[model samples]
Target chain A: MIEITEVKQYPFIEGKNLTLCAPNKDNLNLYASWDNHPDARKYARNVFPTTAGDLKKYLERGQERAPREIGFEIWHKADCKPIGFIGFNFVNWADRMGNIGLNIGDPSYWKKDLGMEATYLILEYAFNELNLFKITADMYEMNTPSWKICEKVGMKRELTYMKQAYVKGNYVDTYQYCLFKEDWEKQRQKFEFK
Target chain B: MSEEKEEKKELVCIPFIEGENVALAPTNIDHIQLYAKWNNDPRARHYARNMIPHTTEDLKKWFEPRGGLTEHVGFEIWHKKDKVPIGTCGFGRINWIDRNANIYMNIGEPEYWNKNLGTEASHLLIDYGFKELNFFKIYAGVFEPNIRSWSVAEKDGFILEGIEEKAIYVDGKYVGARRYRLFKEDWLNRKAKK
Candidate 1:
């Protein structure tokens, strides 16, 4: 729970509805709350309790791998508060490829198409600014919202692994979606129209 | 006197993986000077793409414990017959959550070049990634001009995944990089056939 008075933003990629900002260390408490919140924790697979200490270490590790990994805090412009996270989990510079990850931890913000807009913004940054040739995202089969956002952002289902993850007492399938720069360029028009 | 001094220097290699030609040992901090030399070697650094000088202090940071699951795991390549270190190789840019890692190798000793040690080392490292680390995919990137490394990847059952045109700046000009990948299932099938 970041104190509302202490909420500060550092916009790295601005979107129509949201801004992908540099991850704020001060928001660790809020991140931990999301990890424990029932609505947000299930899809994120935070079965185990997460403490602010854990998130602080994660943020530090993310910074240590800055060259190969980039992370962002998704900020809601109207609310002036953090809503989610989106960034490349890892980038292969030699191959110009990266794996993206996104989580709208605030359930109140779900179903608003904020995720899709954030995806489009990150895709544009990944291809144009990062000069990445390919971007990939993966999710559990149960995580429909996440994959749907990936699909809407021009990623195509590339691979499916049967029973890849155990969730809620049963194994579930996992899917990988990929978008090449050339393919995304063709599909960018549709997002631009939005 | 030089030979006596060299003999007096303690060998601190702990073999982590053994092969027919060479053994992979946990990178020794005492060998930081050796690692630094390899990074600055003319022939090795050409393919290694180390334009800036790397001091022993810079190399020592790599050997320090970073307190959690490490994204990069480097190993010293030791010649079995000669009982001396020849080069370095291992996994880097590991995506543990996705179970994928990038495999890289550099035979620092120019005298050790032309031998099939790279091929042997790649096989051992890839096996470690797939079997021990439970990695789903292993990747290798080779510069367009480094045909030897390309052949090594080809011989190690890695498939040509893609090529990034002019992706890396090397030797004062840009060059393409060939991305190679091997899946754990495919590797297991090959092992079964063998």
Candidate 2:
């Protein structure tokens, strides 16, 4: 006879290979590892060192719904583990717009198209479910892969700020990508999204 | 009448920055009703793009200090002569590492509009951001139809950074939002020339 345990995940939005779920405190250790990882932190815009205690506090606060921010944890359907995070950070309800943020924490999952799928899922939820008019994303010019994922999701490069951000002792340009709901509605059909 | 008097007695204005015509003061929790009035007033809230109705309970949460490093700093606009709070203004979404923040203001009292108070407030707040707060830059966004706001931004020497197309929805139509930026170096140079 054998005993087995299951990882409980509360999936809020399901995707092809991934699902966005409510962040669980049981995964704090995994979240801490990702927050401290150099490559992940660079693209995630974590300027200061993040502690486990900080992550705990964040999880505790996440229990309540915040008016301006809505976040979710990305659970890899096949792997049975949380691999990333994605959400709308600045939701302007009156203007019907939001700023999107996504972080693929697991290094093993990088460049696997999981992030791209997650982006599409979130966009559908934003426009179709939430009725957001516009969605915007910002990224460092050096982070080509991140911006590429945004472009594949029908986002356009709206503006470039010269030397707007300082990262690792060097100033870098920041790019803002925007997509309107009406335009996404027209393009989502091409992605086979009903 | 007695209850109103009790509420008036609780109102306290603590000036943080003083200008000739208006002084920047910490927001008084006792004046949540007044702020709610301004937030819901049709004529006053039109240019501010406040579409949602705000209740006193909703505003109390906003006024409550979220302890620790705050990303926002709001102040009540106090008229010197009349000794009354006419509106509110401050910096929101402050990026400490990047040394930048978004500045916004609303003259809630319609009678106070076009009195150069906004110009005075902008000058005082901009000076405080650069000199006292050691901020590198400040950003502002004005809806395309808001000529008065852009005029004040221009008078304060803010340069047009970019225009976000069809970003805001108003009156069943979409409108662009004009972005303006002011750098500390440019402000200093302008002052030297003056």
DockQ, computed on Cα atoms, for candidate 2: 0.44
**lDDT by residue for model 2 (B50-135), tens:** 77788999999986658777898888999988878889999998988888899999988889999999999989889999999888
* Candidate 2: segments with Cα more than 4 A from true spot: A1-7, A10-14, A60-68, A77-80, A192-194, B1-15, B29-33, B55-63
> On residues B59-94, what C-alpha lDDT tens digit does candidate 1 reach at each position?
877866698788998899999888778899989988
Weakest lDDT window of 10 consecutive positions for candidate 2 chain A? A1-10
Contacts from the true interface found in each model, as a fraction, amount to 0.04, 0.36
lDDT of 1 by residue, A31-124 (tens): 8887788888887767679998998988887445337878889899988899888888788776577889888888889999998988898899
Clashing pairs in 2: none
Report the number of the highest-TM-score candidate: 2
Interface DockQ per candidate: 0.10, 0.44
Per residue, candidate 2 scores C-alpha lDDT tens digits across A102-177 of 9898788999888888899899999988888899999999999889988998899887776677788876778889
CAPRI quality band, candidate 1: incorrect
